[model samples]
Target: MNDFPWLSVLIALPLVGAVAVALLPRDRETLAKQAAFGISAVVGVLAIVMATGFDSDGARFQFTETHWWIKQFGVHWALGVDGIALTLILLSVVLVPLVILASWSDAERSGGVDGAPPKGSVKTYFALILALEAAMIGVFAATDVFLFYVFFEAMLIPVYFIIGFYGGPQRSYAAVKFLLYSLFGGLLMLVSVIWLFPLSAKPVGEGGLGHGTFLFTELNTMHVDPTTAKWLFLGFFVAFAIKAPMVPVHTWLPDAAQQSPAGALVLIVGVLDKVGTYGMLRFCLELFPGAAKWATPVVLALAVVSVIYGAVLAIGQVDLKRLVAYTSVSHFGFIVLGVFAMTTAGQSGAALYMINHGFATGALFLLVGFMIVRRRSARISDFGGVQKKAPVLAGLFLIAGLAGLSMPGLSPFVSEFMVLAGTFTRHRVPAIIATFGVVLAAIYILWMYQRTMGGPVREGNESILDLTAREKWAVGPIIAVIIAMGVYPQPVLNIINPSVHHTLARLDRPDPAAKIHVAEKVAENGARP
Candidate 1:
């Protein structure tokens, strides 16, 4: 298993599938959809196989593979997964097939983008999904900084077309906005990555040349100066925060979500957004612990602001898709909060939050997409009393909505609780303020559900249909997983906790000892006598 190229195979399968799907007869949309779904499913299966082979108690990075790629610059074709990356990789692969199934007929339904005919073919849309999957997997699996950057940048092209060519009337605007924000972030990261090569080769006394390696393992050992490391950290952090779509830099998300189809959103907001938070865990902190600590106060402040800001903004949204987007901005806030809390539980919870958010938000996007298809409108006022006619659709939407609010008995609740609990132990003020996000979440989620799914059957909603069999197949598994994981999250926790410890180890940080009030009082007085 160690010798096999698990990551390489996982990445290649999707690329090959995309090419094959594209090469098929252009007019056969149904065949293209089926082929895309089948290929994505196979990749998902392989990802599961890879997961089963992972040993939680074993090496920090399992199934390792390293080969020199750019010897001149000390880069390598390195690939591996720790618990953190594995969960995210699994989340990405698992969602792609479901997105395919949910999107089976969506491409055909697309209308002109702002009166301009769609530029891409139906098969091309399917092909892009496969291509995007390959890039996504590569980004998470790449241990080499250069390779990661390559995949990171490559992901934008497919999404650009998906939104600009296949989305709503304002899709052109939204796609361009998404692209520009992403490009700016990527440019900063590129500069940071470029600087690393030379730093790695400089003499040891000058904080360099630990065998001139760019492998993350080797790079972690270098002793860079405070000023240089801080600049590098900021470069990477800004790129990730934009990707994390944190406040100030997070404006691209709602616009993009408002225009994109639901299936594309499943991966877009659900998994793709996670790369930002993941990079914070993987690159920013481990590589520059001093800067990370320096930036913690500001980072936590912004995270809380994002939580409250997103939820409050969500309350005012009339568009269903855009509402869900704000909620995710809020959710990602929680994930980031747990991460920088510097507690084992906090980091683990953040990682777990990434997976749970994917399931919950993916389902919400798909279900909302279904309703829009029925009525050809994404407005909250356009829907009412849908449950009377389409109980199952309404039911699943409600479940997904509840999960978004971190309702108990759903998977998100466990992760959200862990994030808060872990953060409270380390940073009480931020954790307390962030708790209000839960209350605000209930307002946004339930309010959106009521407006869209709960009223007496509105005039146009009378003919609304329940989910088709294929739609159920697409969304049912996600709901079931949500409920099951919420009930018992230990299995996933086992995989995530070790990686959290490793990250904390990089910072030389440890879980704070429990503070007992009784012991403190007894010590103050001479004991009760």
Candidate 2:
């Protein structure tokens, strides 16, 4: 088992499942759906196994498998995971099966806003979803810079079709917008990728005399001029910021989320968007530490703006899906801030926040999807006194909402607190301003809940049914993880800390408190003299 190719298996399982799904008889939609779910479930189990076996104390990459793929271009099919990548891979795997179950009935429903008819085959829908899963796993697992880029761009295809074919009236427009934004960012990254190749061509230990290679380990050893490094950093950072959907570049997310189906939205928001922040930690910061430190002030300002702006916008949203999307913008701000804070606690919190946000927001989106399915409307005004008709659903919604607002006993609260605490150690004013976002979070979540679930029963909502068994199964795990993580974060934090420490070590920035302690020791020594 120790020598097994577990990471390869994790990546291959989903790709194989996708092919199997696509080959199923066109009319046998049920069988295709079942196969997709089974494959994703197995992948989820494998991820759990990987997590359980992971050595929390080790900061080095594990389960690594590297093979030269395009030797001429210095590209390799390299894959590996540290605690950071492993946790994200787990989040991606865990969400896929739940997404399949959550959208099973939605897939069967008549398509279009007017109940015209199904516009796409169920077989293709599930198959595309499975394919997307494969790309996500590949993205997290890829240790070669070029291989990561391949997976990064490859992810857009399945999601594009999912949004365009299976989405709402504005599906085409939203999908196009998403593609355009992503493609623009990708092009900039491609230029950076090409520029980095010459730097890697030199021989190992010969300053810059290694054969050109895209392996992260080799690339990390190659140094570039400071001016050149900053430009490359910007190229990668812009691409990731768009994907992270941070404030200004974030415009596409609400539109895309609004038009996409529930399951697709889960993967889009929960897993795919994470690639941005993950890239910043892995590539931008590690590959260009001088540039990262130089750009910190500007980046921190944008992060603060994202926090306040996204929360304020979320409070004004009338569409439930759109509201969830806006809240993500705000949440992502915290993750970015933590990453840029350049502290172990900050990075660890950012990583943990990514996992917790996935579950918390996933529940909110899934539940909102359920409500939309029941009422055939995404408008907040379409719901009233929903708790009277579906107490279980309302209760679940409250829990998810509370988690989003960082209520003391939920998972997000723990991570959010750590982010702020860490940020204050290095940056006091930005952290203080960012705190206002928390207040706005409460206003938006509670206000939305009160209007939709606590009011007098609307005429049509009285007959809306409670969650079905499948819905319960889908949401139950998310809720359980949320509470468990909030109460006992040590397990995940244990895994996250080593990776965070490793990253901070690479950046070589000292903690302010550590500096202060050193100064105190110097004063004591002087007094003794």
Candidate 3:
């Protein structure tokens, strides 16, 4: 029916669910939670179907659905999936259900010492989460810049409330800081986009004249100058960097991660944060090839700095969630390094890193949240020798922690290695400096493990419960996917490679003369492969 109309459904299903939840009686908390989970589950199933039906060899946007959105502005209601977006969309969808389930007991357990959130809080929470789910999918699926920005900006609202209203001791402070930083970045990006739209709208044939379009397909054809492209790139770049929470812009993440509820933190850090890097891939690089190339060296250097700086910071953290947050800063640095390296392996690794980090980091947050709920503490010093009493929980935490630090045979290891290898090909010195980050990661990860998992059983730890069947069910699949993706990454790489090839091919052709010269040189060298 209408070729699956999948993108619209992906965006709509959860939205419709949110409205239904809003209409339900405030007393029906159980039904509200079930409705939200059911909707997310359906969307997740649809996403899997989309992934399975995806053509590995086609290597083009599939099941695309576009319409005239704003005729006056020349923006179209374009939505579709490529290999890259497909993987990310699937990730967002899969994770939402997990978050709902993971938060289920917590939601029931959180209230005014009565084990229920404030009256109507659960309903509101579930609705906002589902709404956020729809928005995240829209951000990934949107092919129109305007549409993308709309989804991008809209996501911040729900998260702000989730943190400010339902978070920890400093929730209000953390929420405001997070909003301010993101808004600062988003505003700059908005100004940049305003100028970019008209240029993209310029007619394609006229070298000086622009095609006057906001559609990605149309914008892709226009050749932007090196100078104008850089300014425009900064608009998107600043927003992405802050979101990536790169060095000098990462101050907000640790506070937010520590203050927000576990489920909220997972979506904000795991899914929403990826948007910054994804924007770089889909928008800046695609639209401003010259600017991306010009900025590569500087970006790579900053990325290395972020890697080392974030890891060292993580090594010193006492708060468990804050420590996990710092690891994200380090991990994102590698993601950015791989992306800016502009190599096929780097891009694919960056993409895979996004997926793997979500699972690993998200699991870490969930585990820590569970611990906090049990002991009512977030300090690493608050935990010790719990392995004796809660072997299952301890083991899950260990697996997620080791994976976060990029243990060998885990998902992050392959992606992290690929990122470094890819970076080395283009930026050798930065690559080497970044390699030390792996050592730093190991130090911090192992130290955290030893401190939290080792030593004598504290007074309260003797009573700690191992993982419940439900908790195991929640975390088990996450670890399973981590292992599966680590061992057999071909399906993802195959889908990723074509797009990476396409982006690089464009970069290698700044001009026809340069394109021909490079082609000849490669041919004369008999092509390494």
Model 3: weakest 10-residue lDDT segment is 520-529
Q: Each candidate's TM vs. the true structure?
A: 0.95, 0.95, 0.93
TM-score of 1: 0.95
* Clash totals in order: 1, 7, 9
Comparing 1 with 3 on TM-score, the higher-scoring candidate is 1
- Per-residue lDDT over 1-529 for candidate 2, one digit per residue giving the tens place of the 0 to 100 score: 4367888898888988888898889999889889999999999998888777778765378888888899888898888898889989999998999999999966677544446344678988998899999999999999999999999999999999988888888888999999999999999999998889987787567454656778899888778889999999999999999999897899999999988998889999999999999999999999999999999999999999999999999999999999999999999999999999897667877888999999999999999999999988889998999999999999999999999998876889878877887788899899999999999999999999998999899977878999999999998899998888877677787777788877788889967654333222221231121
Output the TM-score of candidate 2: 0.95
Candidate 3 deviant stretches above 4 angstroms: 108-120, 203-211, 509-529
Please provide, for model 3 over 1-529, each residue's C-alpha lDDT reduced to its tens digit, 9 standing for 90 to 100. Answer: 2288899999999999988987888889989889999999999998887788888578377778889988777778898878888888988998898888888855555531223243337788888899999999999999888888889899998888877767766777888999999999999888887786677655456466543667777778877777888999999999999988899999999989887778767888889999988888888788888899889888988899999999999999999888999999999999999888777667777887898898888888888877877766778888898777788888888888888988766778777877887777667798899999999998998898888778888876777777777677767788888777766666677777677777777777322121223322221222121
lDDT of 3: 0.81
List runs of model 2 lying over 4 Å from the truth: 111-118, 203-209, 514-529
lDDT of 1 by residue, 42-99 (tens): 9999889889999999999998889989887787999999998999999989899999
Alpha-carbon lDDT, every model = 0.88, 0.88, 0.81
